[model samples]
Target chain A: MPNSETMAGTSAAHSEAMIGLYDVHKSFGPLEVLKGISFEVPRGGVVALIGPSGSGKSTILRCVNLLETPNAGTIKVGAQTLAFSKRHRLPGDRRLADFRARTGMVFQSFNLFPHKSVIENVMAGPLIVKRMARDEARAIAERLLARVGLAEKAEAAPARLSGGQRQRVAIARAMAMEPDVMLFDEPTSALDPELVAEVLAVIRGLADDNMTMLLATHEMAFARDVADRVVFMRDGVVVEDGPARQVIETPQHPATQAFLAHFHRR
Target chain B: MSGVSYHWDFSFLWGYRTVLLTGLAYTMAYTVGTILLGLVIGLVAGLMRMSRNPFIRGPAFAYIEIFRCTPLLVQIVWFYYAFPILIGIEMSATTAAVLVLSLYTGSFYAEIFRGGILSLELGQWDAARAVGMRQGQLMRHIILPQAVRRMMPPFINQSVIQLKNTSLVSTIAVTDLLYQGMLITAATYRPLEVYTLIAAIYFVVLFPLTALGQYVENRLRYAE
Candidate 1:
């Protein structure tokens, strides 16, 4: 039998061609944040990326949405080839915005539009960017809020909500766009310890439905429970990639082992 | 001699009522006109200051800085005298008052607009951009509403001050509430009574506007 790690990596990568990054390099001034990173996020599957702070995991996720343009190499999301240095187009290119409309990103800070009520926040992307009708946007926002268990708080401003509720509302807002891919950047990290599970539960439900997801999370149980594969990063490089079972159970890289040991001990 | 039949002379208010009323009308007109014009200019200048290009932001910065550093009275006098000299527009004194008032308020409004935009969290911009909102769309849908909502109180305060500032127009021979009060009191020699009556009229006008400001603030309190 093939090694479980290799099989897991290959199986996870080959599941679908939803997103691919080829030798992506990103630098801010003199500091290189991402050094030739490569990965494939399969459609309708969940992949959890874990690393220390500043390991470039979030930067990679941002590049997928063209939020941060990689200095070198290319990123392909769905059928769109995102901006790269070779193309000489910044991430704010028209196509990048179009591509962003097709992808939903849940921020760590839950930056819900403060001026809008919860349902209005959810409806904003659909109505403003997509030019959808108001009544239709309202209905769709209601449905997404229901999915996230926040239907009751629809008319309330995000400030009236708890951190967890606001994060769920943020997720619903992103989902209301009916995006093809959803990127979660430490969705639960901003919540209180008790609140984290509720947000994670909503994400776990998304995983069960086979929603295309690329999650950057710190919760080990979340990785083991929901992610199809777990990619470990250290020092701006992917140190290990394998099925969640093996990666969590038996990491091969000395760096992964040391990282996990330091992490879990705390 | 001590009893000089001193009573609150209520007749000056009615006798000079038309003049005071006309002055109040001029004050209201100038206040509203300046507020609207200033808000529009401030919005544009504030956005230019926040823009990426140094060419754009630099001039906007200079505009805001120069106006904010200079006194409103100086600006008003300059607009009234120097601007007309520069442009060769022979306008009336009252017209000059309105024009100068708008430019003065425009400077303060620019500061208010810039401060409101800067107060927002940095993450909000990132999220707005991530959602594919163009700069214009983001301002319309996300940024401006929040900024305008946050800015209501200060704007209202400016209006109250603006109403009081209209008294300064008397310096340039434009008859306003204070000037009208002065003309009547000087002629009639009822300084205490006339001034007291003037204070009462100011109360009547400004109290309602301050109340409106408080109401709007209370209504939008949930924005926090």
Candidate 2:
């Protein structure tokens, strides 16, 4: 029952797990993406899911937000719990929406609403979903824009921004919701090489603020530096899960070692 | 072939100016009314076409396909001539024309709406949902704002065709512009000048609309 106020100043040692997935299984037609995946992100924790492509890292992040429904297992975020199986049905849209509202997600593509100005995109969830007053929403949006270093670009359309700038706006948009947990599905993967650091810096700032996050990223060094824990997956199962430095630097599993080898090659 | 020219005189039709103007008014009225009604139908049917329920999707599919595949003239005639007989109510030619034309235009507009919505990348939906917006709110605020921009060119294209399709009302004995031209031709016996004037009037009205569509397309293109 940890709240954001209590969670904010705490470190990853906080006893409560903010997000929990137990034996989560998801399949897309014939291709099974998540096979009995289980994990937890403790309150004020930053856990990074690192693996090569098709290792279900993105799928795991998506499932936690209910973006991709799991075929079998339980997902608990905040106070809401959803169990999916043959006998158990996915929650109704309203409940699922309520569940998702507690968690914010940022996509690889930086899907900013193209028609809206930067501020409007950030304000949309509050203004439209929460039915917050316009002035209040604008205040929150402006603060978030400033936080992401995009305050001056607030009036510009999303189509007009650079890739890094757009991703920053996306992070701001997600933050405006003030969700208990944040999900980043390859946030920097779509950015230019020069732009990746700026986006990652914003994420690093969030980690410093003690925001609970589960990110699936290819940025190995950032994960090792910013994330409190790392879960290494390959072929839809966790191969290694431990402290960020140990899992990335020293590996007990040969599979994990071989995977890290590719990134280590000079 | 001999180069023979008949006398061109529009003086006789000057007396029928009021009638032609009234006819033009009817044409404009039907176009405006039907386009508005058609848009409502289009929005509803278009969303329904995307529904997951078979019951909802099936009927929308039938309505769009049945109207779109048939000729407008045939639909106008059937509604005026055949529909009333089946319904056991005597419908006025005006009522039948409006109803038939709106439904006809709606089918095309539905496809345009659907295509415009689908044309957006899947990331748009994903992003909106990530923000916790419901289906209706997402479509209204996020999806539609972007989709409407993509839909503008095709929407205008369909609406232009809708203005021309209003001409089909003449077959149902509605006094739209073309029907007035027939009356003028019958009275003045100058089919050549009368029909020419009618074609010129239609051209004058529709040319600007197509130009506006092109302008909008360009603006949207540059906007991206």
Q: Which stretches of candidate 2 lie over 4 Å from their true place?
A: A1-15, B1-3
TM-score of chain A of each: 0.92, 0.93
In model 2, pairs of residues that clash are none
TM-score against native, each model: 0.87, 0.95
Among all candidates shown, the one with the greatest TM-score: 2
lDDT of 2 by residue, B1-224 (tens): 23266777888778889999999999999999999999999999999999999999999999999999999888988899899999899999989998998999999889989999999999999988888988888899988887888999999998889988898898878999999999888877789899999999999999999999999999988877
Give the C-alpha miss distance for residue A37 in model 2, angstroms: 0.6
- lDDT for position A35 in model 1: 80
Candidate 1 differs from the real structure by a C-alpha RMSD in angstroms, to one decimal, of 4.2
**Candidate 2 chain A lowest-lDDT run of ten:** A1-10
Chain B TM (all candidates): 0.86, 0.96
The local lDDT score (0 to 100) that residue B188 gets in candidate 2 is 72
